[model samples]
Target: MDSKIPQIIRKSFIKEIIKKHSNIKVQSGVIDLLSECTTVSVSYISTICNAICNRKGKKAIGDEEVIEVLSKMDNEFILNMFEELRK
Candidate 1:
C-alpha cells in the first residue's frame, strides 16, 4: 500500500514512533492509531518487534528489546519524525 509518509521518511518515522512511545502500552496504542490513521499496519508495533527479531543479524526481541532500539535512536531522527506528523 502507498504510505502517507514516503519510504525515505518512514524509516525515520519508525524510529520516532519507537522513541516517543517507549512504554509498551503507550507505544502499542500510538502504533495502532498511526497504523489506522495512515492505513499502515505494516509499521505497527508488533510488526516492529517481529521484524527486528526476524532480521538475519538480529536475535529474538521482546518489548524491552524494542524499547532499547527505539531509545538509542538519535534525537534528530526523532525531531524529523515528529515534524512530519504536523504535515
Candidate 2:
C-alpha cells in the first residue's frame, strides 16, 4: 500500500471538517497533524478490513467487513451511523 494518502482526505478536507465542527481557530500545524493522523487512521482501518477479508477467504473487502471492523474498534462509530440514519 502506498504511504501517500488520497487527495480526498487531504489537509483541506480536514480543515473543512474541523471548521464545521468547532469555532476555535486551528493553526496550520494542527491541521497538518490532523491530516497525518487521519491518514494513519485510515491506513490502520484498511489493514484491519483486509485482515477480515483474508480470514473470511474473500479477495475484496466490502462494506460489511468495514462496518464490522468499525463496530468492533469503536462503539461510537455505530452510534454515529445511527445518528446519520436518523438525519
**lDDT of candidates 1 onward, in order:** 0.56, 0.80
Most TM-score-accurate candidate? 2
Question: After superposing candidate 2, which stretches have Cα over 4 Å from the reference?
Answer: 1-9, 82-87
lDDT of 1: 0.56
User: How well is each residue in 1-87 modelled by candidate 1, as lDDT tens digits?
Assistant: 465456536545765867787755445555555645554533454566776677745666665544545555544664465557647
Query: How many Å off is the CA of 13 in candidate 2?
Result: 0.2
Q: Count steric clashes of candidate 1.
A: 0
Model 2 residue 55 lDDT score: 90
Query: lDDT tens string, model 2, 1-87?
Result: 354546445977887888899999988888778877877877988999999899999999877776777788886866587558756
Please give each candidate's TM-score: 0.25, 0.74
